[model samples]
Target: MNAPYIHGRRRTFSASAAVDTQNAVITSIKTDDGATWSDMGRVLGKSEDRAAAYANTASPIDLPTFLAGCHEWGGRFADPLLALVGGRWADAGAICTGDEAAALTIANLLPAIIAIEADNLTEPHELLPHEVLIRRVHALTAIWLEMIATEKGRAR
Candidate 1:
């Protein structure tokens, strides 16, 4: 299989047609609302050309530093990054503490995993495989980590 990042780029291209460049960590979004480049440029503290260039091909060395800016793009970068790590946005989703998240993740995952093993799918992907119950544990792990971090006041 290809590297995780290669798959990430593939999914990014598949999910958001605007990320038309390889190795691109971000994309210039142009929805019906407006052109996002200018605002994105401003947010990243760079000119439009500079922002576009960074979005097009953020080198691996610069990616870590640049990602701090990308996070400000809201879900534009978040969603793709989550998907890269086998996840999706859950901000407007469930609200639960680490304990609750554990119970919820287990309560939700057990049956589906059993069903999958038994070759019985109760429902569709609900949309994407990433949205399936099989991924609940992974997402929940991340959630719980953050929840713990927050509880300990170590969140960044």
Candidate 2:
């Protein structure tokens, strides 16, 4: 049985399930996104028909194959798999303006961080609801990542 997280129930990582999910990602790139397996093949350095077989199978795919497939269609389908590994994918083209992102993030993340216990729990008064916490984290992460990316862009 998978251990329960006080946060939530996350599934145990199954290699077989992950392979199936990878194959599904490949197939969706073809069926939903109108990406030819040949196009995926080019992306992954394979032949016109090479990726087609992987699209229809339960076999394990290379990391490049999984990444190329996800890149074609965006992360709506891939987020669960990424989350399973404690990872997230973001679009390189996402845009934000001014101090707008930081302001929005701060406004959303209510229940101020006044008391962090020695244990890991926040004081009851300082805790946001679970849904609010999730939203705030995503907001803060995007804002911070965009800040870093902007700085890197300027340095180039």
Candidate 3:
């Protein structure tokens, strides 16, 4: 369960709030003078009314909350990648030979994943217009999920 935050008293992370903020940021990006909610909704796969509400009722997405979501999302996907690496290690030990080649292949890929994960989590929505940033994030997340599924398949 997410923790309740009382700023002056106790502070806790709220994933829901983060998502809400993300919704708002997306709205803000879509509703700029140059963009319309309909266009934004089309890009984000949301309905026009939902997009407008997000824009109209949007609140600032706190940096910490946004960063936390990024970390959580990345971690959810990274688990399988690490497991695949572990399985490769196990295979090496079982076969009385090191699959250092396979291991090395996975190792080489880790840096790119780490870098991408960092960017996905830490990059501000403000860096790009609303539609571009949101779409990029969605694409990155899809890639991350694919990696996890592939890794898990390899592990089995």
Candidate 4:
């Protein structure tokens, strides 16, 4: 006689890799279509080196601050500028132009995604879990919505 055996899959998370992917995505978006670091750098009111350094970090602490500053400077366009830097979908184009509730829903979910990446993933170098990566994509979309909302709010 043999007893049945079952094993559950172990889930892993990688905050570092998730953050890195996020940075790479953002960098790609910001540099797209002849956009220069100096143009974006103006948002931070800092020299190119300083702006690049802040953008390259894995931490999100500076992102919110930077975006707020950009809003103060560039007005409605700032939303799209920040969205581009956050790596929203290419189709997302500029900032979101409609749907306030939905946008906020997406924005609020980013922390959970970050938490998942911070918790349930590990590879040879500790990459984010597949689920977390998916969440990051979703978070990027949400950020786009937030940007749109920012622009719309300013318009009204």
- What are the RMSDs of all candidates, in order? 10.6, 11.9, 17.5, 18.1
The TM-score leader among the candidates is 2
TM values, all candidates:
0.42, 0.45, 0.26, 0.30
Best candidate per lDDT, number?
A: 2
Model 2 CA deviation exceeding 4 Å by range: 1-11, 67-80, 91-156
Q: What ranges in model 4 sit over 4 Å off?
A: 1-13, 44-46, 55-63, 69-156
User: Which of 2 and 3 is the better model by TM-score?
Assistant: 2
Output the TM-score of candidate 2. 0.45
In model 4, the worst 10-residue window by lDDT is 1-10
Whichever of 1 and 4 has more TM-score, that candidate is 1
The lDDT for every candidate, in the order shown, is 0.53, 0.64, 0.47, 0.52
The regions of model 3 sitting more than 4 angstroms off are 1-12, 31-33, 57-156
- Total clashing residue pairs per candidate? 0, 0, 0, 5
Ranking by lDDT: 2, 1, 4, 3
* Residue 151, candidate 1: alpha-carbon lDDT: 65
lDDT of 1 by residue, 19-124 (tens): 3332354453434326576765676666777666656654321454345554565555556555554554555557734434567767876765565557544555
* lDDT value for model 2: 0.64
> Tens digit of lDDT per residue, candidate 2, span 87-138?
6667787663433565555655443442334456865554644456546667
State candidate 3's TM-score.
0.26
